[model samples]
Target: MKKLYSHSSFFIFCMLALLLFQSCYKLRGHYGGEQSFEATQRPVQPTDVALPKGYKMEAVATGLTYPTGVTFDDAGNVYVVEAGYSYGEIWTTPRLLKIEPNGQTTQVAAGEKNGPWLGVAYHDGAFFVAEGGTIEGGRILRITPDGEMTRLVENLPSFGDHHTNGPAVGNDGYIYFGQGTATNSGVVGPDNYDYGWLSRKPEFHDIPCEDIVLAGQNFESDNPLTPDSKDKATTGAFLPFGQASQAGQIIKGRIPCSGAVFRIPATGGEMELVAWGFRNPFGLAFSPEGRLFVTDNAYDTRGSRPGYGNGDWLWAVNSGTWYGWPDYSGGDALNTDDYQTNKEDPKFILAKHPAKPPRPVATLGVHSSSNGFSFSSSPAFGYEGQAFIAQFGDMAPEVGRIYGPVGYKVVRVDVKTGVITDFAVNKGKTNGPASQIGGGGIERPIDTEFDPSGQALYVVDFGIMPMTEKGPAPRQATGVLWKITSEGGN
Candidate 1:
């Protein structure tokens, strides 16, 4: 108790002096937000893609976050949408960038949440970006050339494991977009039995099932079931039992969200279904001749994780056609025996649908994750109708799903002949031991677009693995925007 008050006062005085000194030190430029890049010495060099002899590549702009989708206005200005981490991962924001023809890039919109702007298209003098959706789901956004953004459509179902994304402007003037399924396989019931259950478990569950299962039928009940009771008891299940019914029995069409293509009118109207039965359609485009093309990712499972034997495809999409999923892969549609059967429903259409009429226009290598494609509009390259696909490369290596030595490359597909050839390759090596490139290098070329002048092609490199285990510290900055100019062009 001896002079305790005085001792406390002395300590407080010392703390105040230290705080003042620290403030002064920060004000003296020792700290405080650091220095801007412009405040430092020279400007950072642009990151460019290395192209083959007939072509040159350069980075029109750098320092963008995760620039996934890129498009050009009719006036030749470049517009890029950034998926600020928020795709799948938490805390990611969204942004949009504008690049002038002279290579000056500026941020038009930033700090937007729930926007992994996966796809963008120019239509009707406005820029449309597919913001993978907000926390509420995916949406289509309209942005003016001056950076004003408006919501065109919202509440689109995108929360499924495989989300709704990838929007393109069709020749018909409608905006075409993708909606992906939630499950890997279109299996009915909780046990997740396949088509084989028909013969294997005829007594264990009802046999010879219909497509739509009645509700509440899977559960066992003691009472003799009445018609209304059976209907009320049937819950959507594998075998029609109790009140439960099979998937195809109750639902008129195939299961919802097995992946579908939709068209939205530019002037604002109801969204219409264009196609169904896709796994994950990442890119959509129309040929100069007005044919629709879509690149779909193959279904991946434990045995097919790396998708080595399975082939990805580019299809000439037709209206109301089914690009078989779970029921088929590559050009081979799985036999009906591969699926399960139930007793409650009859007339179950077997998994006998052809994926684009037994052939894809071109077959991309398995697990290539072929994404955003653009037909070359350039006259100099003489590739007016040729399509270029950005291959994200194979992710699984332990499964021996090797995609050649050149991992990250864009492939050019001959629309007429369905021939595929390497369009360009990234020179830098990848970091992983099994990585095709020696060192950690350019990765996951996500999207591509031709310059407004149609003289060059711009590719958006997502620049990192989509999934990473607890190993390795997370690489924070990994996205890049690259440009490839055709040979002999200015």
Candidate 2:
């Protein structure tokens, strides 16, 4: 996912000014390390990472290019998606590499010259993949056992930081996936210029009249705003996720082709919306009890539509419920600072939703850039029924100065209590100052999966994305497929 904040050099300067005046910043629980740029210091190999007692880590496959998602076949062969040649530019040639148990590897399928493949899953003799969109829109592609590929869902709205991700198979035998929006929020404004054509697509802005709201100086719409008084140009429409409006009608067809979870039968059928209102829902997993869970990337407080003061979230998904995007963060009203320039702006007032919004089960750190996660169910691994999330870490001067080193390790979330604990770390407690956490520790752990036997986990370490200005700092051919298992087989 491309972050608008990192691209904004001007914002970095402003944040630097703020940092100079501040001293003795108290440590917050959300921060993973000190608020300083860490130089990429060490080579991150399997042996260099730290693990818990009786647990061992080893590199199973090396030399991958920005690998994002991983899965395992019934026979124990590992399949990994290499988000090929990403300079944050969406180009295909992304390959689905199969790493056998014996260490042999081969490309099972390669994406066309388009965008990268962000997610993959193995089910019922086929590999389901989430192909991101740039030249084209995102789609769900299936590679059969013989390597033939077919599209299941095509042309979803994807042209910004977040792409369509995850196609996890649900208990009901449906394949579920998440489609992200074009802009950070509803209207793509001047703050999101780096996205070029994405922020200017008129078709994407089409929404129902009843869903419009008076935002900023006027009712901003994806469609070009007409010059008029705020009171008349946009009368009053429910702000979709419950922003104060003159008209309290709950409407649909808002924010075209974005921020929705969809499901389709394994045999293939029309994709239907399961839920909506996620900023960037990247990871999807199902618990042993068949409940759906998602690891969502929270808002960044930079760019034209920056959201305020809420972290990424882990949600227990329920069908047909809205999870609050543009209007709210983590089920609470989004901070007024996000949209309004003046604190006293009446637009900051809240509105009652036609339906109540759902809250996250657990809150994660802001800009942690969480991606894929899986349920740890095997008792042998000692975290039965917990979700292990791969935090890709933050990569911006603004985030590093404020939130510190947010995410770069695998975190375990207790399903029952929503309590989160660090299950695996690169170097305990001292994750930031940037230099101390890289090279040897997990630089950017992107995805986690359980082995077929459920005795170990396969972690995809997306090598060397430091939380600094010149970040997205890739350690070429440094991506590794790691195996986390108990020492001496427990």
Candidate 3:
């Protein structure tokens, strides 16, 4: 990650301009007013990280660029992935990296595809990568140890606010991945414009995995694509702006649909739907018992269908099942006064339901951004069946207004009882990223994995990417990799 950014004057000027843009909107009261992007003087050592009573955290590697996930090969060599995009419109080449025991890192592979590569996994002799597809489109790629790469699936609808997330290889020898929705809920609104994608991909919109009938719900917003300020567009769910859906209107679904989970042969073949109706199911992993689980990032209080006080979720996957999206959270309908983010209360946009959505395994924070997770299986790990999830934290103002910071820690969840506990976090009185408190601790952890022996857990920390008002000022080479091991009795 060295030489990626030299703290150039041009970058600094851009950040200042971006800061000025965000300051103008602070009077709204609900949007981000003040922020912290200044680099901290205190370098956070592993000892600065807080862990449960009997565990210890150590720094394994540092100075990575937007590192998202980590994996291990058969020989026990460590591998990590760097997501290419930083969301504040910062773009860099996504890379696959191999870490040596001495702490030296080598770039195993670099991507040509549009990025923010969310996750990766090793199956057989190759690595499966989830290309975020922020601009061109989401894709799944198979890469060898020597850097050769091949696309297994392409053209996934992920050019909106979200992207393609997981590539969890199931025991069935098929690669399962999650495709995120484009808009906040369904309708393309001015919020999409703020995300900087709606204008670029004016025709881009969410696609359903199967045929669906709409309830004719539509949202009105000033068209960002049009030059006229007064021109408005009435858009419906799953359709582009200016396109309207009537009552009982049908939208055809295709294979690589948005807001759904799909599977394809590990070697590459026909893509099949495992489940549908997820907002942005970012993380996917299989438990020791073979049950598939995912972490779904709940809706933000933005866009046309924003809902308030909704938390992220963890779900146990079932084939041929429909987990609620847009219409529900935690298996409950969204049309409620409590969930009302704007003037009118939100309501169901679908004409019919496929089936009753199941209850979530557990519920996380409202803006925790609960993401990549792994189940603890080895007895040495102590948690056994519990799952450890990395909360990437929240992006205020961009996502929505916030009273205080949320997430920015690791939590252990008891899948059986649906209970949760903080596992690893920054040493702070306030729950937020290190930048918020000026410490060199876990800033934003994105993903983690237990070693082959299960004696140690490797965490991928997405270093300091703090809110700079309208855009995030993500520092290159700020990412760090951490390891956790049992210290004593638990």
TM-score of each: 0.69, 0.79, 0.91
Clashing residue pairs in candidate 3 are 44-440
lDDT of the candidates, in the order given: 0.58, 0.67, 0.86
lDDT of 2 by residue, 1-490 (tens): 2577666876888889777546313332222332222223345456556676788888787767678889888777789998754433323368889887665678888877556677788888888988776557788898976688899888777655567889799878889998776555554543333444433442343132124333332243232233443422222222221122443333456433567788888778888888887878899999978999988887665543455555789999998887876567788766555433223322322244325578898998777877899997787887789899998876554332343457778888997898988777766455642234445557678889888787889898876543223223454565778889986544
Distance from true position, residue 349, model 2, in Å? Answer: 10
Compared with the true structure, what per-residue lDDT tens digits does model 3 show for residues 1-490? Answer: 3454655766888999877656634522333233433333436588768888888888888878889999999999999999988676778889999998977799999997499899999999999999998877889999999999999998888899889998798999999999999888888888888888887888888888888899999888787787899998898888887798899999898878878999999999999999988999999989989999999999888887778888999999999899988788889888888788756778889998777888999999888999998988888878998899999988776677766678899999999999999999888776777766657788899998888788888889988876765566777888889999997696
* Candidate 2 wrongly placed segments (more than 4 Å): 1-42, 85-87, 90-92, 102-104, 196-256, 335-354, 398-403, 432-438, 466-475, 488-490
How much is 382 displaced in model 1, in angstroms? 3.0
Question: Which candidate number has the best TM-score?
Answer: 3
lDDT of 2: 0.67
The model with the greater lDDT, 2 or 3, is 3
How many steric clashes between backbone atoms does each model show?
51, 8, 1
